[model samples]
Target: MSMRSPYPDVEIPEVSLTEFLFADGFGDRADAPAFLDGTTGDQLTFTEFHGLVEKIAGGLAARGIGKGDVVALFAPNLPQWAALFHGILRANATVTSANSMYTGGELAHQLTDSGATTLITVSPFLDRALAGATEAGLSADAVLTIDKAEGHDSLADLVSSGAPAPELTTTADDTAVLPYSSGTTGLAKGVILTHRNLVANLLQVHVMGSVTDQTKIMAFLPFFHIYGMTVMMNQGLHTRATVVTMPKFDLEQFLSITQKYAVDRLYIAPPVAVALAKHPIVDSYDLSCVKTIFSGAAPLDGELGRAVAKRLNCTVLQGYGMTELSPVSHCMPDDRGDLDLNSSGFALPNIECKLVDPESGKEVGVGERGELWVKGPNVMVGYLNNSDATDATKDADGYLHTGDIAVVDDEGVYSIVDRVKELIKYKGYQVPPAELEALLLTHDKIADTAVIGVKDAEGEEVPKAFVVKQASGADLTEDDVMAFVAEKVAPHKKVRVVEFIEQIPKSASGKILRKDLRARETEQA
Candidate 1:
């Protein structure tokens, strides 16, 4: 006999403008610290967390940002990032996440795209965020500030002056959050996650993982990303677990926080995993209590995983997800009885996973490689302004086709073999050459470069580079650029062809336009 859902037909929960997550955990633990901002030593107990959200929501309600209105959060991973985000949803309104590092041009695009009427930002980034908002012709009705909104009325002040949240009703299908993602072929598109979608995914993780009251987790990941929003912030809130947060991924700060909080569960990305595996500063921290380190966002090399586990003596479970699946469809928890490296684990309790041919819509046979498709309450409602894109990704049969190519083994372990869209196809085999190109561009006297797949001697495709050199100081040659990239990317993905260009075109969201590069090469050929 196997365990199953009590309400199989029941859907995910939506934003109901009344109950706070902290109160849902327990009234007794209401005063328990939910977030500790390691940067400022500021901590918010569950009582304060709920109270602030109520006040913020009340204030927002006063401003007429009710159901369906969008609010933007352009702040770091400080304690207030959560309050404002959850508060916006509490009013049955929508939320759009923006990176604090975005330039005015970048920020304006998203603000206008989301039609966000309210812009909530921290003080340090206020000037840039406000400039962008103003340039976008968006003067937020409620300009709430975090710790330092340029001497403006802080979120704290608004929460204090406003009344408690008024009861409002909502359904599970109601849209709650709008987090953006750079899809397979386009710029960043808003991922509209309904309350049910988010709640369902979190519930899946809650059901599978062993998050007890004793759970002391580290929250260094940005609050903007779906992975951190659901797993670190939301998951910790409901479980009555204490989460120590770091606004930025500073190795020294991370070390200090672990010592301060005696952190247990660590969640990080591949880049951070590199630091854990190779950096010497980590040895200074007492990580004996650390039971698990969950890695995701990008692929983690099996070698790096082993190195970190050997050094830290903690099981590193690499989870897999995209912004579309409410951020997580599978969890390879460290305590997973018998899971191997590179295996992203199987579908969580309520999810249905399948494989489909990338070129055709037909489902592939078992053990065959194909696009990983997912179906569950956690799947997003749709892309905000692109119905065609939404329909293309999500099939009529209800499965959302992830552009990632993977093979599921008989043991239920899912390992991503390749990213179909992110690939730089050379000959026939694809190459993921990202940091390799960035490193090449950074070599002495090189200005900028973009490595793309192009035809070679045997009429087989190989990597080619378009490099722009610094005009003033150095006379950089095409050979110099090729050698730089050759040292980094694999032989097949090495720059066999090189051309001088004035600029390497990129999308608005900063991703390189490899298709445009391929077209340029064909034009030259």
Candidate 2:
């Protein structure tokens, strides 16, 4: 039997995302700061942001980008990023957000896979963007920078077109954003989030959080990730809250911004919670204005969360989500700081969840661990152009088989304990083992390798590789392996730990038996 959300279902409108967010207008809050650049102290008010959206839509339309075209955004978190995102939607186009940390080759996959016609990035990332665009068979002319570049079209150039904004033809069902994720286990594929998927999630989340126009949100998290896209960026807009943006996270910078902006609500991953609890520098700044610090992306340690709450005298909450579910399914409400921090509070309204024993294929009673399956309007339509993967994840019955093993208490509070999927979450970022395995094989020193998530001394999940060294690679050191991977992938995806073995455990089908590797880690620990 499936357990329904304790909260009553909220109605989801059938309008497009742009219409839902902008059609209502800002009213009295038109002149209120919608977004502020924490580093530069630049801001865009609600009225300015809305006007920019129109100009950007006209700019995109003038550039021959219209209904059904996908534009790739490869920039850091800036006020312009939000405007460009909505502008794409307003022009009846889709936005495929790329990881800002991605290497040229890594980004090329998304650009090619998403079939993006134009790539927009910042001047600082022009090298990587051009390299990716070139690899994806796009000419340099197709690349546009958010900032002014010597040779390429800039955001200023786009708005200068002065063309009238095109009509919003996209329906709620049309794909709005294609954020990539390694669903269950595989290379990252684009997750097809329609306008309804995006809009529904905002509505579902609104009921659980206490964000209002008076609320100030600090967004140090990357905007490309679903957690930030839905919970931070769009949610802030929906509530007319002021969102302070940071290009990247720095401990001092984050603290200073929170204090400077009097930010009340903070959306973060577990890693930030670690800093707040243990970092001594956190005490230098007054975070008294902070009301809530909500952690998502990965599980948060109850003890650590409590420490932060006690240290800052604020409420600390946790939530559970996957990129496939438009990111949020279960989360602690703003007022429920009394609940166990380990448990990801209640399922959001409009969502029905089932915890089924993987082996027995039966619904587990309260207190028993099982794979979490969710059915909700916020769920993605499917993976883009990947029917096999879609069928594997979402069943014909409309339930999305989230490969997370979780247990719910009598109160309907759920806690994720293990994962049936092989994807590793390193500081809230998905690091696919298959992608690393394939990359590692290219090295002559590595014969066979399997990667799995292992807890470090700090209790953070890092990628650990079990390798069978090539006979010629007897001198290959762990540092060498780490360095090789660090050079190729993002910082979070680097192989932090490596071990040499005579063989890697494998199943009859030649699949890497990661469970055996995990067991070995346990025994060793």
Candidate 3:
């Protein structure tokens, strides 16, 4: 892989995962809370966290777990989650994070795919994880429990054994993490992210002014998801920031945490942004403490930015990335678009981005729309055990072709103008649904919007949109909305058709479910 960047001063760490964070900056930091488990008063300091990692590492070592082994972490954002992550890395093993909300079927597929031997999970999910493991043909050696370990060993107890850090030499290039991603058009595939990949993103995110030791970050996003895993958990540790975690995202709990910790940073999705911009409950808490509020997993509306900025008086920054790139490709710079105003901003300092024509691999003109291509050390090594998909995504020159259609000007500001596959193709021309969707969100009257293409009788496709009106019982006709989009976009880019619904379907990661919406259209037809 090419190891050069536009900015020559970019630095890459030459240390192991344990050494990079725990060994380097961990001096007399035991007293400070390393993690605050919001579900309970369980807080671990740097010493405690490090101690637990050693114990878990020792336990895994005793069980013959060694270098290059894959471990499954099947739980939510809790103390044990982080412990398992570090412990697996400490044992020179790879960690594959699984979404806690997944059913046994989903869990089975990932477990089978990653070829995991050991699964560390919470007590509440032990039965499900075990059932999933058995079904997936995993001969489980250990099921490290999170809380109650009546029949199993508690993760805390394993770490509290007072076991010291084990003697081991590891490399940053050794694969440390295995995150999964559903590509632009396929079932989910495991992503191979080395310590270098994760650490690179951590370093880039740090250099991009992500957060610091002084920043109080509210961790409501699910750690199982890459966005939450990298930003909330790993970034917090790398930066020595206080992570105020939530077991789950409750609007009241979210605001309470904000007021409780005087949170300086928050990484949210579009739904939470909607709540912040419009939810009446937000007014009760003082959100002025937040210096930076980031939105990912879904595209954010700059118009919502205007509304939220008016209320919070903070920088609302957004960037576009997926699990394939350790989940973050950019952080809206404090200077980009007048300081986190609009646009996803330029690629990270060490990251290279180019706009490429979807059909042809040719570069597009500056400010012209094309599928965005990303290349950086932060990009995942490849999809785990799926070389075909990996080869297709990452080109010969190391560029990870992001499926998003974007426009980049000379200023380095990139806007997610449309999606390559997600866009609506009218006749032969392309229609940026995001443009129409953003316009719809700006209307104080409309709440939710999703645009998808449905096949016509002539075997062609037409743009059809489904809307979720904000006000209850509001009478909105398709023609009225069509007129709104037609007035804003080109003749072919017009909505053409609209259907009002109670809600718009979205993924747990916060992306709009265009496929689900298309399925709805199929059902209707």
Candidate 4:
């Protein structure tokens, strides 16, 4: 049977993201700080930030990039990135976020797959972006940098242009963001999140967390990722929260910024929680300003969550979501005194969840493990250009199969037990085994290869490769195999462990028997 959320339904506005965020005179409050650079102490008030967004949109329209165009945004967390992101939406264009750490080959795939017409990046990432854009058939003029470079137009030029704002003609169903995901299986595909999908999720989490204009948050999570894009950046803006932006995660910098800003609500991943629980450096900084820590994008052990909560004397909670759900479907209640650290929390308003047996395709009763199926207004329209995948993920009844094995208790709290998919969770970032295996095949010494996630010393899942070396490649070492894969992918996708096996077990249909490998690992342990 399907389970519905216990909370009352909320009215989700059928308007553009920009309209929903600045609705009912929220934008008129010009004196409130919207975004702050953690390191530089630069701040942007609400009026200034909104003005820049419109100016950038006008500039892009004058450059022949208006409605229905796809723009690739490849930058770290910064005040300018936020302006540009909304600017694209203002022009009725879709923004596809590119991971900041991607290599040339990896970036090219996303650019080509998303059919991006223009690329926006910072000066430091210009070389890779230019190369990837060129490979994806975009011209040099199509590449724009946030900082002034020798041959590229800077973001300042765009903002300073006196071009008139293009007429707004956006619909709630129009695609807003095209964040890619390796859902359930295979290579990355664009997850088409429309304006309504995002707005609904923003309101869902806002009411659940009781977020308001007074909330202070940190933007240490990368804006390119969905969790950060929706939870921290968009929700924080919608609620008029003071956001302390960081380009990347540095423990000392995070603590210092939290202390400096008196940040109350912190959105983090499981790895940071691990550091907060075990690292002595956490004791050095004043974290008393932090009232709540919401961890997502990966699983957090119960003991680790309690340890951090105990030390900080604050609420440490967990949420569960995927890219297709606008990144949040369930979150813990903000006011609860007694917390179940292991439970992911209740389904948000307007969301319905069910646990179904993977093999039988039948819904299971509560307290039993089954693949999670969620239905909500926040669900994606579909995977772009992949009808088969879209059909496989969402059922005829409209539920999206999450591929995460979960169990729900009598209190309606959900806890993830295991993943039904082959995707690895490397500190909350997805590391698809198929992508790594395809990369491994390109190495000259590799005759055959299969990749799987193995538990590391810290009990975290990391990519491990089992390879069959060619007769002439007898001298190939584990380091050589790892180095070859690292050059073409991001840091998190690198192979950490290598084992030589004569053969990779596969079924007659040419599917890798990952279950066999997992069984062997368990047997060895």
When summed lDDT is taken over every stretch of 10 residues in candidate 4, the lowest stretch is 22-31
Indicate whether candidate 3 or candidate 4 has the larger TM-score. 4
Candidate 2 residue runs with Cα over 4 Å from true position: none
Ranking by lDDT: 2, 4, 3, 1
Candidate 4: clashing pairs of residues? none
Reference-based TM-score of each model:
0.81, 0.99, 0.79, 0.98
lDDT of 2 by residue, 264-291 (tens): 9999988999899999999899999999
Q: lDDT of all predictions, in order shown?
A: 0.74, 0.94, 0.76, 0.90
Report model 4's TM-score to 2 decimal places: 0.98
Error of 3 at 467 (Å): 21
In the range 1-525, model 3's lDDT, one tens digit per residue, is 122233434688887767878877566555777788665657888777877788888878777787868889988787668877898889878888887766565678788898888788888887778778888886544677777757776776666656554577679888887776665545567888878888788787776674767777788787877888888898888878777788778899888878876888888876678788898999999887988788777667688877886788887888778788987886676544364455887677688787888887678877688888888888888888788988988889888887889877665767887776564444433455665687677766688888777766744457777888877538777887888776645455677778888889889998998878877887999
- Backbone clashes in candidate 1 total 6
- Candidate numbers sorted by TM-score from highest down: 2, 4, 1, 3
lDDT of 3: 0.76
Who is ahead in TM-score, 1 or 3? Answer: 1
Number of the top-ranking candidate, with lDDT as the measure: 2
